[model samples]
Every structure is written in structure tokens, then in C-alpha cells.
Target: MATARKYNVEAVFKGAPKKSDFKIVEETLPAIKDGEFLAEAIWLSVDPYMRLFVNSSNVGNTMFGEQVAKVIESKNENFKVGDYVAGMFGWRTKTISNGDQVRKLDRSVYTDDKLSTGLGILGMPGATAYIAFLSICAPKEGETLVVTGAAGVVGSAVGQIAKIKGCRVVGFAGSDEKVQYLKSLGFDEAINYKTMTSLKETLEKTCPKGIDMFFDNVGGEFYDTIIPQMNTSGRVAVVGCISQYNLENPEKGPRLNPSILAKELTIKGFVIYNHLPRWPEAFKAIGEWIEKGQLKYNETVTEGFDNMFDAFSGLFTGKNTGKAVVKA
Candidate 1:
């Protein structure tokens, strides 16, 4: 029998997740039956959404995450040995998958680059930014675009894509380093939300012409602040809200219905899972952008499977500038 090491949730998260909330356990695996493949995890993803996804009901379960893995052994004809797969296989060293909800990564998209990017720019985060901004915001050339969480995986991608569309992009990140990173990605302006006394004032200064599109990744006060500054008929894509993810009780949002009405803003909330059928399109476009040097990205990597929780918690603390992944 083969054994697998997996991180299991030991306690439900209270306010912020703690080290004591998770424990590693070993499990013995039986040989793969027909139509099954055994995969070894190479990289694991840590994103802000994970904090809200895990709840009391999932205690003692494997910690949830996506992984890019190598198929070492297979009984399924569709999944051959040596193929790379991306799946929601949680924080486990190995997975026995029957293919459901698993995607075989196209080597053409990744080339010799880090396979971990399947969990980053070329994966969910990529699709999130591509479809959400293009379809929802419908950015036009010469428009003004603002993105919250601008140094994060989706936000960084959003700003760069807007630049490609010839939009003037302003980004808000938590730290000075992240602000600089956004500037390097060609953002017109990058604001450090933590150090700024008034987010509204800084945004007013950067977006003097008013924001035509808002790609919101962090809600709460920042999201609220940007609403009143939206140009008439502006568009907003409501992505993940990392700012409120760790809270035991979500704070009450400011009343902004008046701003939406006055501006006639179009706001839509979306999760990338709803757009999974279009992932191939996103991959093609993002891959081309990468090849042509139109898109740039960064990753904050923690080098061990044992450090998975630490990497996950970094999403909330703004410790990561872009994608946060564990090199398993």
C-alpha cells in the first residue's frame, strides 16, 4: 500500500486562522482501480477565497486548495502517465482522481516555465481577470480603470489587461512594495491604502477624470469609496473581497445606493467557477499575452508543503505581491 500525507483541518477558523487549526495526517492508499489515476502534487495554491470557503462543517477534512500535479500512474485511458493535471485536490501530497473536475494542463501553454503557473496566471486567477474585466467592465481605450488589491493575482492581471486595452489604470495595494510592482506593470498610478490617510482623496488625485471602470477585489471601505467617483454609466466587476474574508462578522457596508443611481453604474458580482466553460479562451489569450510580453506577473512562493497554512494566511496579510503558492 502507498501512503499519502495530507493536511487536515483540526479546528474551525475563528477570526484569523491559526497554526493550531490544521494538522498533517497520513493515509494508506489502495491501488488505483479502472478509470482512475494517481497523481503527485507539485504545487498548491493559496488564495483569499479559501478563508471564506472553509467553515465549521468541514472540520477534520483535508484543507481545501487547488494543485498542479503529475500523473505518475494511471488506469484511465484519457489520463496517461507523465501528464500534468490541475484539480481541486486539496492539500495532499498525492491524489487518487477519477478525473471528475480535473483539467489536464496543456504543456504548450506553460512551456518550460514553472508548472506552478497553472495555479496562478494561467489558471483560475487568469480566467478571473480576463473574463471579469473584458466581459463585465468592457473596458474601452482611453478610459480610466481602477483595481483594488492591485498587486494580487487577479488584480495585477486586471491592471495589465486594462493597459493593453489602452486604459489609464490606477491600482490600490496594501504596501509600498506592491504599489511599486503595480507601477512596473504599467499602472498609471499605484496607491498604498495602508499608509494613505484618505483613500478617497488619493483616488481623487489619481483619477482626476473620474473612474470609468472599477475592478474590485477588496470590498469594505475601499469599494465604498470608489463608488461615488465613478463616471456616469461606469462599470464595476465585483470580484473577491479579501478585506472582509477573515472577519468573524462582516462589517456593515456604507449606503451607496444613491451613488449607483446618480452615476447609473452597472455592477455585477461574479465567481470564476461560473465561467469555467470559457477557460480555454482565457488560456489562449493570456498565453499569447505572456508570449508577446503584454502581461507580467509575480508570485510569492513558500517552498514546502509543511508551510501551506503560512502561505494561505499571507493572502490576508498582504505578504504576497501576486500569486501565493506552496512548492510541494
Candidate 2:
């Protein structure tokens, strides 16, 4: 028998999530059946999507998330004992699986010290940035690209990839620190939206050529403001609406239909899951970039599983500059 500790939903989220919304519970696990394996979580990911998804989750369901785990015991031939794997194992200390929705980690891609990258740049966020930006935006050399939420895991990757493609990049972030971080990543201009006296004016000055492509992670007024500033035939990838996720009621904003139509903008919303078949393509290219020193990433790691809620809540406050993960 094995004992597992997990976080369960205690109440549906209202506005931003509170620690009281989750409760930790412990349970004993049965012996592994044939074809099943048991794993211990090493790193757990806390993403913005969890806040949005929690509203629809039932009370008492384990908090849903992805993790990098090490198989401690196994009856499955494909997953040997001591194998490292990444999967949607929720926010649990341990998991038992028959290998569905699990992928063994490629040691060649990341060494043990860097296994946490599986939850960050070398993993889902990385793939999302690579595939969505390249495929949807179809960036061209000398094009000007703007990335909102530009210091985040996906956004930073998007900006760097755009740079690699010879696009001049302007990034918008919440703090001066993040602005500097975006600059360090080679953004041509980094605006701290909170400190800016006028976003519209700053955008116009920095992006004098008008935005040819927009990677929008923060939706709401930012999206409204940026859409009208795009060049003709611009492309917009609506990857997240994190700005609206915590609101009690959706914030109202000016309609942009005229700008969209007049500019002939191609706006599309995407769920990373929808592009599953192309994940390998993204990972392969991103890995090569990392090896060639064309890409860099950072992670804001919280030390304990008990602090998962804190790490998650921090996302709204601009506390993390890159990926936010919990070390178990």
C-alpha cells in the first residue's frame, strides 16, 4: 500500500482563487494492478488556465495540473521502474497510471538538474509558443511583432522566436523588472504597462511601423487598444485572456469589429490541446534553438507543495517573470 497527499477543490472559485478554496487530503493507495505504474511527483506546474478551469470543476475533485514524476514502482513493461515521465497527474504527491496520457521523459533533451524544464520552456509552454506563433502568425523578416504578457513562459518564447525570424519585437509587461527581462531576451522595446503614462502613446512611439503581428495573452483593454494599431493584414493569436480570468464580471470594452474588418486582421483563439499532433515539431525546433544558444528561459520555483496555492495566486500579481512551478 502507498499513501498519497493531494489537494482537492473545496469550493468553486469566485473572482480570484483563495487558499480556502482548496483542502489537502491524504489517502492510501492499493497495490498496483497489472499494466499499472506508480509515480512520485517531482515538479508540479501552476498555470493561469487552472484559475479559469477551477470554476467549472466539481468540489472535491483533485486540483487538475501537470507534473514531472519518477516511476517508483511498475507492473507496466513500457514504463520501467526509475523512468521519469511527464503527465497530467494533477496536484498530487503520487499517481498510479496505466500509461495513458503519460510520456516518458527524454533524458537526452534535459539532464536531471534541468528536469523542471519539462514543465516550462522545454515542455508545454515552450511548444505552445513555438507552434502557435510560427504557424498562426506566419511571421516574416523585418515584420514588427508585439507580445502582450511578454515576460511569461509562452510570451517570452514567442518574442524570442519572432526575433529569430527577424521580426522586431516590442513587449508589454507589468513591471519594470519584467521590462528589463524582456530586453535581456532581445526585445527591441519593453514597456511596463503599469508605469506607462499612456499605453497608446508609448505603443505608437515604440512600434512606429505599426504591429504586423500580435501575440495577445492579456485580453481586455490591451487587446482593444492593440487591434486598432495593427497594420493591414495583421495576424493576432489570442492565446489567453488572463486579464479577464479573475474578474467577477467581464470587463466591458469598445468593440473592434471595424478595425478588424478594415485592417483585414486574422484573429484566432487556440487551445494548446488542439495542436497535439504538432507538439513534436515544436519541441524539436525549440530544443535545437536551446542547443544553439538562440533561446533562453527562466522559472520562478516555489519550494514546497504546500505553497502551490501561493505560487498560483502569484500569477495575478506579476510575481513570476517566467514559468511558475512547485517543487515537491
Candidate 3:
């Protein structure tokens, strides 16, 4: 019999997840029966959404999330002993993924590319940024688009993809370094939201006229500040809200959303899962962009699988300069 070590949730999140909320437990695996394959987790993903997704899931269950794994042994014909797979394998060192049990992943996305990227730029966050901003916001060339959380994975991708669309990108990030990073990625302006609370004044200086679109990665006050500055008929793609994720009780939002009605703003909320059909399209473009130097990505890697929780929690505090990941 083979044994697997896994992390089972011992406590539920009260607010922002504390390290004490998780516990490690081990399990012995039954021998693989017909039709089942055993996979080993090679790379695990941690994102801001986990802060919210874990709230309803019960304690004593496997932690939720996806991983890129190697098929170390198998009985299923579709997956051989050496195939690489990406699936919702939870926070475990090993998983049983039959063809029926597996989440589909195309190796073309991560083979020539870095495996960790399948969890970041080439993975979920990549698909999120590509389809949400392009299809929903529909930025046109010379249009000014504003994005918050510019330094994080999804935010960084949104800004860069907007640049590829020939739009003038104004990015907001937590620190001066992230601001500079956005500028280096060819943003027209990068605002350090921490240094200046006067978002309206900053918009006036950066836009001169007004913003045509907003790729909102952080909701709360960030979007509220930018809402009134939008050009008429502007589109906004509501992505993840990291700023409010950790708060046990997210504060009451300012009443600025009402202005959208008067302003005739077009706002849409989306998840990448809804756009899975376009995975191939996103991979081709993002992969080519990387090869041609039209796009770039940075990762904040914390060493060891043991540090996963710390790396995940760091996403909220601006502790990471770019897409945060754990290196096993």
C-alpha cells in the first residue's frame, strides 16, 4: 500500500486566514483499482480567491485549489506513467485522477514554458485576464484603460494585454516598485495607491481627458475612486477583489457605485471558467507574446511546500512583487 501526506483543514477562516487555520494529516492509499491513476503534485497554486473560497468549505476536508502534477503511475489508458497533468487536486502531495476524475490541462501551455507558469501567467490567472478584459471591456487602440492591483498576477497580465491592444494603460499598484514595474511594462502611468489617496487628482493628471475602460482587480475604494473618472459609456470588467478578501467583514462600500447608473457605465463580472473554450486562443497569444517580447511576467516564489500558506497570505499584504507562487 502507498501512503500520501495531505493537509486537511483543521480550522475555518475567521477573517483573513491565519497560519493556525490549517493542519497537516496523512493518509494511506488503497492500491489503484482498475480505471484509476495516481498523480503526484509537482506545483501547487495559491491565489487571493482562496481567502474567500475556503470560508464555506468545512474543516477536516482537503483544502481546495489546483496543481500541476506528474503522472507517476497509472492504469488509465488516456494517462500514462509519465504524463503531466493539471487538476483540482487540493493541497496534497498525491492524488487519484482517473480520466473522469481529472481536470483537463493541455501540456502545450506549460511544457516549453515554465511549469509554475501553468499556475500563474500561463494558467488560471492568464485566462482570467485575457478573456475578461478583451471580450468584456473591449479596449480599443489609443483608449486609456485603468487597472488596479497592477503588480499582482492577474492585474499585471491585464495591464500588459491592454498595452498589446494599443491602449494607454494606467496601472495602480501598492508600492513604488510595482508602479515602476508597470511603467516598464509600458503603462502610460503607474500610480502608487498607497502614497496618494487622491485618486481623482491622479486620474486628472494621468488621463488629462478620461479613462475609456477599467480592469478592476481590486474593488472596494480602488474602483470606487476610479468610477467617477470614467469616460461616458466606458466598460468595466469586475475581476477579483484582493483588497477586501482578507477582511473578516469587508467594510461597507462607499456609495459611489450609484454614480455608475447616472454615468451609464457598463460593468460586467466574470470568471475564467466560463471562457474555457478560449484556452487554446489565450495560450497561443500569451505564449507568442512572451517569445516575441511583447509581454513579460514576474513570480515571487517562496521555497518549500511547507511555506504554501505563508506565500498565499502574502498576496494580500503586497509582500509579493509579482505573481506569488510556492516552489516545491
Candidate 4:
């Protein structure tokens, strides 16, 4: 038997997550049996959706999330030793899996053979941005597109892709630092919603003509405000609503009743899992962009598996840039 460390929830989050809410417990793993493989965790991801999903996460159960792990030993011929894969393996240092659905990552994304990226840019968030922007937004040259939560993995990718498609890109973020980061990625305008003008005022000033597309990551009031600023026949990809994730009995934002009719908007709410069959398409496109200096990405790495709660808390307060990863 081998001892494995895992973080489990002791209590559900009340508002913002607290360190006292989680506990680290040691569990012994049985030897790998037939059709089973053992993987050691390399990196774990902290995402906004995880915050939203806890409404149903069983108290005292292992926290639910994804990770990049290397198959250390295997009885399954499909998952051989030294092969890296990503899966929804929860928060554990070692995983005993049947080698179900997992994808191999290209080391070109992050050299040193570290498997962290399978959880971040090269993983779910990357796929989310790719499918939604190209399939939903379908930005055209000179069309104006605005992205909310522009500093995170999906938002950053959305802005860059809009730029690649020759769309004029505008971004709204929580902090000035993130605003600067969005500008560096070639966004035409990056507005800090915290101190700057209201979303409607900023939209009026920055994109006076009206928005042709919107890649929405922060919903609630932000969504309500953005709806009226859209041009006729505009498209919106509602990827995630991170702003409302942490609130206790969250209040609804402004009503979007008249704006949808007025703007004739196409709002599509989606999950990236539906586009897994087309991942290679997205991977190839994003890979080329990274190779050609067109797409810029950043990861905020927090070292130590013991600090998972701290890393997760960072996402709620906009403490990270681009993608947030925890190095085990």
C-alpha cells in the first residue's frame, strides 16, 4: 500500500472560500489491478466553475476538479508508463484510474515536460475560447468585439483570437494590472470596470458605433449592461458567469428583457465538452498562433499541493493573470 494525500472539503464555502473550509487527509492506495493505471499528480487547476459547482459538491467528499498526471504504472495497455494524461481525478497526489478519457499534451506549450498545462490554456479553457469565439461569435474583419473577464485563460484567448480574425477588440477586467495585460495581448481597448466608467458609459465611449460580438465570462450586471451596447444582429458567447459564482443567495442583476429584442442578439450559452471531438482543430490553431507570436498566454503558478485552497481563493479576487495552476 502507498499513502496518497488529498484535500477534501470540510465545509461548503459561505461567501469567499476560507482555508479552514478544507482539510488534508492521507489515504492508502491498493496495488494497481487489471485494467487499472496509477498516475501521480503534477499540476492542478483552480477554475471559476469549480466555485459555481459546489452547490451540489458533497460535504466531506474530495473536492471535484481536473489535473494533469503521469501514468507511473499500468496494467492497462492503453495507458503505458511515462504517458501523461488529463482527467477529472479530483484533488489527490496519486490517482488509480481505468484509463478512460484523457488526452496527451504537446510539450511545445510548456517545455520541461511538466503536465500542468493540460489543466489550463492547452486544456479546457483553451477549448472553451476556441469553439465559442470561432463558432458562436464568428468575428469578421473590422467588427467590434468586447470580452469580459479579459485577464483569465478563456478571456485572454478570446481577445487574441478576435484580433487574429481582424476584429477590433475591447476588454473589461477587475483590476488595472489585468487591463494592461489585455492591452499587451493586442486588445484595442482594456477597461478596468472597478474604477473606470460604468460598462454602458465605457461602451459608449470606447465603441461608439456599437459592439458586433461579445465573449462573456463575467455575467450578472456586466451582462445586463453589455446587452444594450450590442449592434443589431450581434452574437454573444456566454462562456461562464464568474461574478455570480461566490455570492450567497446571489441576487439577479438588471433585467435583459427589452435589450435582446432591441438588439436582435444571438446569445449562446455553452460548455466546451461538446467540442471535444474538434479539439485537434483548436489545438492546431492555438499552437500556430503561439508559434507565430500572435497569441500570448500567461500562467500564475502556485507551488505546493498543500496550498490548493489559497490558489483557488485567488481566482475569486482576480489575484491571478491568465491561467492559474498549482504545482504539486
Considering summed lDDT, which 10 consecutive residues are worst modelled in model 4? Answer: 105-114
Between candidates 1 and 4, the one scoring higher on lDDT is: 1
Best by lDDT: 2
Model 2 vs. true fold: TM: 0.99
RMSD of 4: 1.5
Top TM-score prediction, candidate number: 2
**For residues 1-328, what per-residue lDDT tens digits would candidate 4 score against the true structure?**
6678998888878888888878899999999999999998988888888777775455788888899888898999988898877889888899899977866555556565435657766788998899889999988899999999999999999999999999999999888888888988999999999998566778999997799998999888878888888899999999988888877897867778688888788999998888789887887788789889999899999999998888899998888998999998
TM-score of 3: 0.95
Sort by lDDT, best first: what order? 2, 1, 4, 3
Whole-model lDDT, model 2 = 0.93
Residue 30, candidate 2: how far off, in angstroms?
0.7
- What residue runs in model 1 are displaced by over 4 Å at the alpha carbon? none
TM-scores, one per candidate: 0.98, 0.99, 0.95, 0.96
lDDT of 1 by residue, 75-106 (tens): 99999999999999999999999999999988
| lDDT of candidate 3 over 39-156, digit per residue (tens) | 8878888888877777445588988888888888788888888787778888888888766636545666567448888888888888888889899899888899989888888888
Residue-level error in angstroms, candidate 4, position 5: 0.4
In the order shown, what is each candidate's alpha-carbon RMSD? 1.0, 0.8, 1.7, 1.5
- Clashes within 3 Å, all models in order: 0, 0, 0, 0
